[model samples]
Target: MQLSPDEHIFWQYGFVKLNATIVFTWALMLVLAVGSKIITGKLATGLKRSRWQNLMEIVVVAMENQIAEVGLREPRRFLGFIGTLFLFVAIASLCTIIPGFKPPTGSLSTTVALALCVFVVVPLFGIEDQGLIGYFKSYLEPTVIMLPFNIIGEISRTLALSVRLFGNMMSGEMIIGILLTITPYIFPIVMTLLGLLTGMVQAYIFSVLATVYIAAAMGDQGLKQEPEAQQ
Candidate 1:
């Protein structure tokens, strides 16, 4: 079984090569872009609205609520980043039902790219909210001795985020591939359904964790557990 879409090369020129991971990733992005444009084109504010508009509202509201629950007081500020992350991962998994499609998340390069985005954005959001000096001060929290550990924590968490996503997605694809070849029938169908569910869960988890990291960077006041800690 192919462990990743990177192995499926479509074209090559010396070191430069196009692979399935890049193709599918771009295809997914295009779908999201066109879908968003179409959905938002006729957004109605009156009593009457299309089902698609209603569905889009529901998704936005739900995502905003989740951001609030994660301790970001202003959900809309973070909605674009968090919502896109969730949608991309969730859609990648959902598309697995289509034959010959592989989720880019299954590839380490893709997962690392996603993780690095979070890694960079977390600090940017923190600095935006806290200022450069204030955000840097977070590294010196509790005591000066903890600075190295705090830095290490940030790096470690980024690595964890990438590996966690890559492992889960790659394993699911591997299992489904194996079953499809060996059994070729009822069991594969069941596994595919389970994989879809797992994909949704992973997408939720990845988004939630990213929000937590951002919240922590934003300061204790913006963390969900801050209230409990004070009490």
Candidate 2:
């Protein structure tokens, strides 16, 4: 079976090449950009609103609530990053209904890139909230001996995020391809539907994990701010 979209090369130079992963990743991003523009360009504020606006509001509200429940004091602060991550994965999976479309998330490069975004953002968020000295000190929490272990844990979790997402997305695509070759057409169709659902679940899990990581990185800043804001 074609294990990854990376195998489908459309163009190549000595050191650079365009593959399905790159093409689809860009295409998906373009769709998101254009769709967001169109949907939000003429938003209504009165009693009546477009269906697209209503859908967007619902999604934003749901995401905000989810982030809040994850212990973030300001959901909107992280909403743009976390929401985009979720939408990209969710839409990439949903678009599988299109013939010849490959999900970029099925590729290790894409997932790694996504994971790296979280990995980088976590430290930045922590540094922003606690300042460099305070954030770096977190590694030696409770004692200095735990520093190396804390650093190792951070690296390991980032690797885990990438591998877990890549494996799940790639496996689902492989299963659907395999089923199509050996089983009835109807079976593959059902599997495709299941794959879509799986994709959405993966997206939710990935975003939530990212939010949790960021919250942890921020240490007790959110907790400290919450009571002050309430008063």
Candidate 3:
């Protein structure tokens, strides 16, 4: 059985090569981009709304509420990043029902890329909320010796996020592949449904963790703003 989409090569030219991971990743992104355009192109303001518009509104509202619940003072500020992350992972899993389609998320590279996006954004959000000096100074909080540890914690968590997502997604694929070989057809079908549920759960967990990290990066400023928001 194929352990990773990276192993499936579709094209190669000396140092450059195209694999299943790259192909599917780009394909999925295109689908998301075009679908978003089509869904949002004719948005309705009146009482009469299309089902897709209603669904989109529901998802946006739900995501905003989730971000607020995670302690972000301005949910809309973080909605684009957080919502995109959730939708990508959730949609990738949902597409598994399609024949001959492999989720790019099952590959370590894709997960690492996703984690790196969060990694880079966290510091940016921090700097935006608390100027450059203030954000960097956060590492030296409470004492000077904690600086290295704080930096290490940031790097370590990014690694953990990537590995956790890759492992879970890959394992789900692995189990279904194994089941198809050793078990009957009906059993594998049941497992596939369970895997879809697990994928959605993983997407939620990943987005929540990212929001928590961003909220932490916002530091005391976020806390200070929270009360004002409540009032």
Question: Which stretches in model 1 have alpha-carbon errors above 4 Å?
Answer: 220-231
Off by over 4 Å in 3: 223-231
Pairs clashing within candidate 2:
none
Model 3, 12-97: lDDT tens per residue? Answer: 99979999999998999999999889999999999999999999999999999999887888899999999999999999998888
- What TM-score does each of the candidates earn? 0.94, 0.94, 0.93
Off by over 4 Å in 2: 224-231
**Alpha-carbon local distance difference test for all models:** 0.89, 0.90, 0.89
* TM accuracy, model 1: 0.94
**Candidate 1 structure quality by residue, lDDT tens digits, 156-226:** 99899989999999999999889988999899899989999999999998898888888888865555555
What C-alpha lDDT, on a 0 to 100 scale, does residue 201 get in candidate 1?
A: 95
Question: Ten-residue segment with the worst summed lDDT in candidate 3?
Answer: 222-231
Question: What TM-score does candidate 2 get on C-alpha atoms?
Answer: 0.94
Give the candidate order by descending lDDT.
2, 1, 3
Q: Is candidate 2 or candidate 3 better by lDDT?
A: 2
Error (Å) of candidate 3 at residue 93 is 0.8
